[model samples]
Target: MTLHGRAADAREASHLAIPVGSPILAGAHRWSDDEGVIEYGEWCLPPRMTIGYEYQP
Candidate 1:
C-alpha cells in the first residue's frame, strides 16, 4: 500500500467535487496471493475527510 498528499489534477478534482489544484489525499493498494495480484485499487479523498487503518499480528 502507498499513500500521499498532493494537488488534485483535473480528473481527481472533478471526481472529488473540488477545484483543480486543490489538496487531496490519494492512495493505491494491491492485495496478492501466491499466484498473482488478487485486487488492486486507487482512491482519493477530500481535504476534510480522514482515513485510518489497523494491522494485527
Candidate 2:
C-alpha cells in the first residue's frame, strides 16, 4: 500500500466536501407590465422545503 499511500487515500476521498445548502428563495420576481400581476415579492425565509439529503457522514 504505497503510491504515496494510494494518493493520500484518493485525496481523502475527494477532499473533505461538506456543509452546503440553499433554499431561502424569493429575491426577485416582479412583473407589472402596466399592472398585469405579481409586484414586489420578497422572502428571506419560510416557504416550506424538506425533501431529504443533508449529510455525507
Whole-model lDDT values for every prediction = 0.93, 0.34
In order of appearance, the predictions have TM-scores of 0.88, 0.24
The regions of model 1 sitting more than 4 angstroms off are none
Candidate 2 residue-wise lDDT, 1-57, digit = tens? 011111122333333231223223223456667758756553333225333357877
> What lDDT score is found at residue 30 in candidate 2?
62
Clashes of 1: 0
Clashes of each: 0, 0
Best by TM-score: 1
How many angstroms is residue 20 displaced in model 1 relative to the true structure, after the best TM-score fit?
0.3
Candidate 1 lDDT tens digits, 1-57? 898999999999998889999999889999999999999999999898967779899
**Deviation from native of the Cα of residue 1 in model 2, angstroms:** 54
